[model samples]
Target chain A: MLLIEMFVFLGTIAFAISGSLLAIQKRLDIFGVLLLGLTTALAGGVIRDLMIGNIPPTNLAEPQYFLVSLLASLSTIIFFERIKKFNHSIAFFDAIGLGVFTAVGANAVLSFEYSQPFLIITMGLVTGIGGGVLRDVFVQEIPQVFRKEVYGMASIAGSVALIISYDFVSPIISLYICLTVTFTIRMLALKWKW
Target chain B: MLLIEMFVFLGTIAFAISGSLLAIQKRLDIFGVLLLGLTTALAGGVIRDLMIGNIPPTNLAEPQYFLVSLLASLSTIIFFERIKKFNHSIAFFDAIGLGVFTAVGANAVLSFEYSQPFLIITMGLVTGIGGGVLRDVFVQEIPQVFRKEVYGMASIAGSVALIISYDFVSPIISLYICLTVTFTIRMLALKWKW
Candidate 1:
């Protein structure tokens, strides 16, 4: 559980930074930057919770989520030049975040006692990529998941791995394996321009 | 209830047409057109339901909503020239749809036993403009509600009227008044470019 929470935290910060950078590029005001950052980090979970009938969403219920995203966004804006120079580092962290989020998302569905592989995988993919899709849309661009590389595909692959391995291995082990596979796929896609 | 349903239907079709027209202008493929149309027609309700903890979203559960949006989108694509020629007619319907949706959204929140005027009004405005926001975002532009002439403000006006009048009039009568006020404001905005 602690490991999962850590993953969620890391993912939140990574996604928030990505959103802030995009918002800055789009020349949005500070409020828009923060708003987009929060949306990109939390909207996916909110959407997932809503689909599963969870009210108010965990993001809304917990201020930490919002604070973390806000801080990350502010940091990105403050260290714009350094961050921009470390583009590869950002992409690497983003891949890890994607993997962790996919695993966490799948695990969330499992806790709901939904055993259907399709549903689990779908939920996981949404949880992983949904925020990015929204962030891209907010900037008035086609979602990168739909247009470029293997972003959504990598998340789906990770989700599939997590769901399929749930019965064969311990949940924690399954999560680690899922994260490894997803991260690898995303990194490879970025490197190879696939 | 019957009258509310009729308004919802009208709003759905009108929003769907607007979505399809925008998609066509963006040169989206057929699938993209349909997807945007459905998103524009139903995403607001979905967002509202999620915030209120309604599961699965009535929009997803009801096939009629999907079908109406799909048919509307198809018609727009097929009769592009004719629809383009009837721009005024489209705007007229769109205004009516906006009014009805604003009323319906406010009423939905009221049913949830939430008496907070601010929350009710915000939800109402969201329910009215959320779909259009999503549509605009999908096409890579600032939301019309944020940029255009009195779009979201008109919805807010309608929402405020609905909430304030709830004590003085029957819900039905309140809805009618809300609709008329919203429609008038939107049309006047259009006419005067407010």
Candidate 2:
């Protein structure tokens, strides 16, 4: 659980950076940048929680994640030019966020005692892609995920793996399997131009 | 209660028709039209249900709304040419939906016994706009509600009206007040080019 928590924060940072950079690119104000960053980092989990009837969504109720994403967004703004000198791409952080969120979301459904395969997979997929979809929507673009089949396919594969191995493997091990599968697929798609 | 039920159906039809027409204008295929229609008609209520922790959301669990939306979409497709003559505009149906959904959604929050004003207002707003937002996103457009300030403000005002009047008035009357406020504001905004 601690390991999962650690990865969640890392994923949060990745998503915040990805979202804030895009906001800057779009010439949004500081408030817009912060709003986009938070949405990218936390909207998925908030939506997942709502579906499971978890009110006062964790991202809102728990201050730590909020603070972490806020700091990440602020850093991105402060270091915008510095980061651009290195040519930091959005895809890299997005991939990491996607993979980790996929596994974490699947695990959450299990914790809530929802074992129906469709629900578990949908939860995982939604958790992984929901934030990005929302970010794209807010930015008024067709979601790249929908356009890029491989992106969604990667998350789906990971979610499916998590569900299959959940009964046999330890929770931590299952999470790793899910993460590895999705990250590998996404990276391959990016590299091979799939 | 039956009156609420009747209006819900009417709103569902209105949203479905509006969404399907947009899809047609976008030159989407039949499936796209149907998908957008369903999304517009039901996604708001589904989101609202999920927020309340209502599993297997009423829209999904109860077959009636789904059927109505489906029929509405089918009719729009069949009567496409005839509808063009009537010069029907999306704004009209959208306004009706905003009013009814805002009222219905606010009432749902009360039924859940959660009295938090922010949450209740949000539930109402989301229920009124969620589906339209989703529809616009799928078409790769900026959400009309976000761009047109009056659209969202109308929903917000209605939600506020519902919240203020809920405690003092009967449930049905409160619903009417919410509906009237939202509908009138939306219509006036359209008429006056606000």
True contacts kept of each: 0.33, 0.24
CAPRI-style quality class for the chain A–B interface of candidate 2: incorrect
lDDT by residue (B132-154, candidate 1, tens digit) is 98888878878888887688788
DockQ of each: 0.19, 0.16
Residue pairs with clashing backbones, model 2 = A53-B53
Give each model's whole-structure lDDT: 0.84, 0.85
User: What does candidate 1 score on TM?
Assistant: 0.63
Model 2 alpha-carbon drift over 4 Å, by segment: A1-38, A50-129, A137-194, B85-89
RMSD of each: 6.3, 6.2
Cα misplacement distance, residue B173 of candidate 1 (Å) = 2.3
Maximum-lDDT candidate: 2
**iRMSD for each candidate structure, in the order shown:** 4.6, 4.5
